[model samples]
Target: MESFFEFRHVYKGFDGRAILHDVSFDVRAGETVCIMGRSGVGKSVTLKLIMGFLKPDSGQIIADGIDVPLLSEAELTQMHKKITMVFQSGALFDSLTVFDNVAFPLREREHENEAEVETVVTGLLSMLDLNDQRGDYPASLSTGMKRAVAIARALAARPKAILYDEPTTMVDPMMSHTIADLIQRVKRQYKLTSIVVTHDTSLARKLADRLIMLHEGGVRFFGTVEEMDASQDPVVREFLQQDELALP
Candidate 1:
């Protein structure tokens, strides 16, 4: 099967400082691929490139058959309807209630009527066990609740692919598991292609059909979870060991 998303010889840098170098990978439709690396390893940068938030210095990023870098801003906006991102910060609107936040994408991008938006957002919030929070605002939510609300908002777009930027970061162990399980559930239910950028090896093991390990601006490993576990690279082993030690 051809790749549903691809990064070919991607190279990105900032002010002469290289961040990603010759990094390349692919994700098939309906597959969940986790990108894992230590902090500042370009994991989130990869996601930003995919979302067209940043451009690679020299590379070709193809998503849904569109050359992302080549698309105009307006074209990219339309393409965004099919590709949504859930930021690690849970980038919710402070002014909107949870219901409205989840419903925002549906209303703005998809232009679904109120009745349709009501049905979709209602079901999503309910599935995420966020029904009671619908009336609440971001300021009133805990870290986990805020992340849950972000996930609901991302789903409101009914995206073909979802990019999660550190979905489990800064959460307690229980909440981390909850977020991981929720991601798995959504992927299976929607058959959605997902790219999760996280440092949590445990979460990667749980949610990744395949793993891409980045080290020093390169792909150190890209294969099944078992392959990653068996990697002989010292960097890979050391990174995994460090994460294991960090667990409580």
Candidate 2:
């Protein structure tokens, strides 16, 4: 299988602190990989590094076989065009209505007419079960609704790879699984390669085709879901044992 994204012994730091250390992982095309870890273990940092929002101190981050570390300003913008992120807080613009908010990226990048944009955005919102809230403002929507809108907006660009940051955050049990199912559908239906940053074990178990567990900014485990469940390493077992709390 071809790896669409690869972390090649990546090392990154801030000020006088170190996070990732010789961190290496890969996301194969058409696979959904969920990153699982405890708080401050650099799970989210890994995603940011891959997205080129933060630079790695040493080593390479390759996406589609191109070393992301070498990408120029224009290349970075183009890369972003093919990759989208669903923020933890939903990241919807406060002033824009749901339709305009979802349409923003599409309008910025593509010369799609208003009708074409509306059709695509409406389809996405419908897929996410957010059709009714299309006319509402971000503030008027609930947290779950906002997240759904954020996802709808992310789809506007028709990204090849999606980075999900704590998608289960701010959602209750009733609506949490919808987000999970949507991610699954987005991967299978759209043939997307997704990198999900989440500490929610249940979500990981449900969404991950492969699971990578991080500890102290280093990878402690990497394998199929069954392998994680059957892990013998104490740290691995201990980490798996905390599946109940679901804390980040």
Candidate 3:
């Protein structure tokens, strides 16, 4: 499979502190890659770079064959149509109902037909199991529900790739499972190129086709779950051990 996203020797920093140095990885077309690391390891920063929200100090950041950092504002806007990010906060419009929130992307395309918007939004809501809450506002929804609605909105854009930022964070155990399952379903259903940034090992196990573990601003490990489990690296084993200890 061809790469849909690639980062070569990417470096980023904030306030004179380096976050990522010589970071490199690639996500293949129609593949799901999970990025896991401790807090402050630049997991989210990687996503921002891919979205062109931030440019690397040096190195290539490519998404769908386009050099993301080199894209102009108008060019980036067009690129955004093909790739979408589901923010950790859900980022729902405070005043919009669930239906309108999901319909927002389609409406932005200037589709004059309300019926098409209804069809698309309803289908996405149904797929994400948000049909019952479609009339409600974001404030009334639980963290998981809000994330679900955010995903519905992302799907509404008909993006070829979707970047998920901590999808299972701050949600209950059951909701976490539900969210992970939803991500899996979306992957199988849409064959989307996906990049998920999370610290949740369980979520990573459930959703990752390949995993990239970052440590100290670089990739510590990159491989499948089996390979990760067999890794003898103390840092990798320590991270996995810590995750196990945290489980109830």
Q: Which candidate leads in lDDT?
A: 3
What TM-score against the true fold does each predicted structure earn? 0.98, 0.95, 0.98
How accurate locally is residue 150 in candidate 1, as Cα lDDT from 0 to 100?
A: 97
Q: List the residue pairs that clash in candidate 1.
A: none
lDDT of 3 by residue, 12-64 (tens): 99988999999999999999999999998999999999999998999999899
lDDT of 2: 0.86
TM-score of 1: 0.98
Residue pairs in steric clash, candidate 3? none
**Considering every candidate listed, which one attains the maximal TM-score?**
3
Candidate 2: tens digits of C-alpha lDDT, residues 1-248 = 99999998899888869888899999998888999888888988888888888889999999877788788889988898888888888889999999889989989965688888889988888888888878889999888788888888888888888899999876887788888888878777888898888878888888889999999879999999999888898998888777755454
Task: Tell how far residue 186 is off in model 2, in angstroms.
Answer: 1.5
Cα error, candidate 2, residue 168 (Å): 0.3
Compare candidates 2 and 3 on TM-score and give the better one: 3
Better of 1 and 2 by TM-score: 1
Candidate 1 lDDT tens digits, 60-140: 999998999998999999888899999999999999999999999888954568899899999999889999989999999
Query: Which ten-residue region of model 2 has the weakest summed lDDT?
Result: 239-248
Clashing pairs in 2: none
lDDT for every model?
0.92, 0.86, 0.94
- Superior by lDDT: candidate 2 or candidate 3: 3
